[model samples]
Target: MKNRNLIIIMISLLTIISCENSYAEIRWEKNLATAIKKAKSKNLPIMIDIYTDWCSWCKELDKNTYSNEEVIETAKKMVSVKLNPENSEEGEEIARKYGVQGYPTILFINADGFVLENVGGYVEGEKFVPYMKNAIDKLGKINVILSSKEPSLEKLDLYMESGNETEATKIFNDLLGKKSIPDEAMPKYLLGFGLIRAQQSDYDGANSYFDRIIKEYPKSEEVYMAHYYKAVGMILSGDTDKPKKYLENLIKNSNIPNNIKTQYQTLLSYINED
Candidate 1:
């Protein structure tokens, strides 16, 4: 009986090792610099898996999502790196830079160091592939834009779409300085950046962006949305009085649609109750 039990234990250990090897098919680079260098050399993007030791979902992502054959195959087209924010100062700084709020946050960045996509939370393998494919498509578009000699504003739309705010702002400032930006595009550019700032929880910065649209392009259709988001940001930032006052003024604006007015009125009522 003892010998039989020992044989069963050996088989279980072997089975576990086999499963582990299956998960190890995709090589994960530990050093960000090395991964970036590899991606640059190969003209590929970098896929960063930002995880923590204590995160159970992160482990599930590794065992279930990353181990999927489809995911392993897709990852071959890019450099995959794992980062533990709690492990090293470099990891912590990188996580902070990318605005990582939760574990298993996947970042897809192009060779030019611009972010292509930021995927937060855990997703299954099938859902995860689309994000990777989208990032890859964006990288291709960025490369095409770089290889062209088109006007700067033509590329501005792509930059904003990819969440490359730094480049988008540079182009925006240049166009604004030269008075070359189209009137219709200004509100959109401002609104995009404002939404991005809001997503990052930088309510003050978001309000500033939204304010630009309200002040500069008051007659534009986007002005209503800009005002709405600005008020929402004020509320999010804990300025109860300002949001109420702002929403009241917005509700009074004649240009606002009846539906939007109702929406704003509802929000205002909620705040008043609060």
Candidate 2:
């Protein structure tokens, strides 16, 4: 019985090892610098898997998401890297530089060494390819814009659609000085960034951005959104008086869209207590 059980255990161990090898066979570079160098030499983007020892989601992402054949195949086309930021000094520095607040941050880095996007959270295998591929595509789109002689809002629009804010901002500043894009295109992006800041609880930062749009792009449809977000930020920042006055002013402004005014009108009403 002991001999039989030993033989079964050996077979199971071999089977598990073989299964693991077959699934996730990414050529993972541990060092970020080495990966960046390799990617730069090949004109390829880098895919960084930022993980930590304590994150169960990170382990699951490795076993389930990276194990997908499509994901593995897609990852092969780029300079793939895996790093445990908790365990390595280099990894921690890289992760911190990219705003990695959570484990399993799938960072897409351009060949120029810019972290275009640091997407967090864990996704399943089937959904992984498109997410990473979109990251790679953002780098390509940004590169095309940088390579062009003049800035193009149309091309920048493509980058925005990919949701790579880091790449978009760099391209915006590099190709066009401040406020180069058409007023219509410019305010929306600004407001989008403002919303991001607001979500991060940077109320002052968010309000500043919103105020810029309200002042510079009064005719823009985004101004209404800017006003709403600014009010929310102000209220969150504990300014009970200022945001109320701002919302009331927004209501009085004929430029604000009627629908937008109506949407947040209740919040404005609530602020009138004092």
Candidate 3:
């Protein structure tokens, strides 16, 4: 069993080394620490391919998934690392830290060692390209937020969806201190502040933040959605009149999407009929 494990580790390492010479050209680091260094210096996210030698799916990733031209091309954009937890103490330790619950888990992480995404199972070129691009896009967006250069509604929405209050607090605090917060980030900032408050059941506070977005960033699309959520909060607080009037005004706006319009329209219908 011991020898077989060693053989597996060797095969995986050689496979990674072979990639450097391949036409597709993926430079995969065998040691994660080395990969982390490269990621930081190069300003690239780390893509860790977690697999075991015995797993058929792991082998399939090599022959099918990783072999794709598109996959190889995308891999070039990252600090690539491949490890089989059985290889060394460093490998096992890294595996546990990342919570590798199963075989063939692909971890997307930043240079700061913050985990971005954990993609399980296998993905083909068509699906894989976008899957990878999505993570990279998110990494760029997150960097902008982290750098306080730009803020993204998508990032805020993601943090809210995942219940990541800690990061949200950090982002909120970061934005609060900046003397000149860009107009691009302001709408997301207001909407995110409102969303965070709403998640905590602070309806009045949430509405205040949402109202700020409407009053200050009136031209932003966030205002339309903000009105919808604020109206929902009003209904929850048993104040039908105010929320209903707000919704009535929301539905009249042609700039908002059909869904946002329908959301307000549906809520008002329910409130009036009740």
Candidate 4:
């Protein structure tokens, strides 16, 4: 009878452990298409967790970050999708579209099917929660832009042209910081323009903003403009020597738009003449 009781107790303990593991909620999806479809149907934002199977950091994010109560709760409000970059075509497409060159890329896509943000690599729960919140806030802003009857781009341009540099800078900076804006050429152009205006007479301030655009938005259409402006700012501030190297780099960079390159070259000629 005692042996029977021991066997029964062991069986009950095993059952309880199995149940606990099984009940542990792992919010994951296999494919982008399916995830998108579900998000669209349910009117939820899409959160893509880009990972590689062999990545230890990726596993840690899954085990610790994703399992954190705050992260899990916040994540439940959106459609969660997992993509293994090494295995799936859908995953590869998302990775390529967002310029995700490395593992553990977290993408937050707004309801209208536009990518709001692309966060790369791993962070712990404390840091991760704020990141997610910021992404969510950006998603909210996108919704506001979409709901407005007036065109957002036009309003943005008006703000820029009217010399409301502070407001324009705020909007763009907010968008960039929040990851609420799309990875479009036009917005980046406007952002670079706004930053230039804000630092018009302040070379140090201007250089900092220009450098940020260069470092963070390398593929932006405004890259040449950023380079040119950086050189101009440096030159105007009597930091002429530093400008020469960047000007040379701009001239050498084959990817720069032709018209912009010509503009920079013209400016360089003027600087040399004086």
lDDT scores in order: 0.85, 0.78, 0.77, 0.71
For residues 25-132, could you state the per-residue lDDT of candidate 4 as single tens digits?
Answer: 557766777777887787677888888988899999988888777887787667788887678888887676555777788888854456655678898876787766
Pairs of colliding residues, candidate 1 = none
TM-scores of all models?
0.77, 0.64, 0.49, 0.54
* Candidate that beats the other on TM-score, 1 or 3, i.e. the better one: 1
- Candidate 3 local lDDT, 1-274, one digit each (tens): 9999999999999999877557565668978899999989988888888888898888888888887878889888888888888877766776776556787888888876566777888876557777677768778876776674454444545554444567766655665677445676778767877876776678998999898998998889888878888988998888989988888877787777888788778889999998
Cα lDDT for residue 194, candidate 3: 80
Residue 189 in model 4: shift from native, Å? 2.5
**By summed lDDT, which 10 consecutive residues of candidate 3 come out lowest?**
148-157
The CA-based lDDT of model 1 is what? 0.85
> If both were scored by lDDT, which would come out higher, candidate 3 or candidate 4?
3
Deviation in Å, model 1, residue 16 alpha carbon:
16
Worst 10 residues of 2 by lDDT: 155-164
Give me the candidate number with maximum TM-score.
1
In model 4, the number of clashes is 0
| Prediction-by-prediction clash tally | 0, 0, 0, 0
What TM-score would candidate 4 get against the native? 0.54
Which tens-of-lDDT digit does each residue in 1-274 have in candidate 1? 9999999999999999999886667788879888988999999889988989999999999888988888888898889999898987757977876778898899999866678888999998778999998888888877988787644786887677656688888888887888888888889989999987887789889989888998999888888899888888888888899889889888888878899899899889989998
Instruction: Check candidate 4 and list the clashing pairs.
Output: none
TM-score of 2: 0.64
TM-score of 3: 0.49
Give candidate 1 regions above 4 Å deviation: 1-24, 149-151, 161-166, 177-180, 195-205, 252-254, 258-274
Preferred candidate (lDDT higher): 1 or 2: 1
Q: How far is candidate 4 from the true structure (C-alpha RMSD, Å)?
A: 12.8
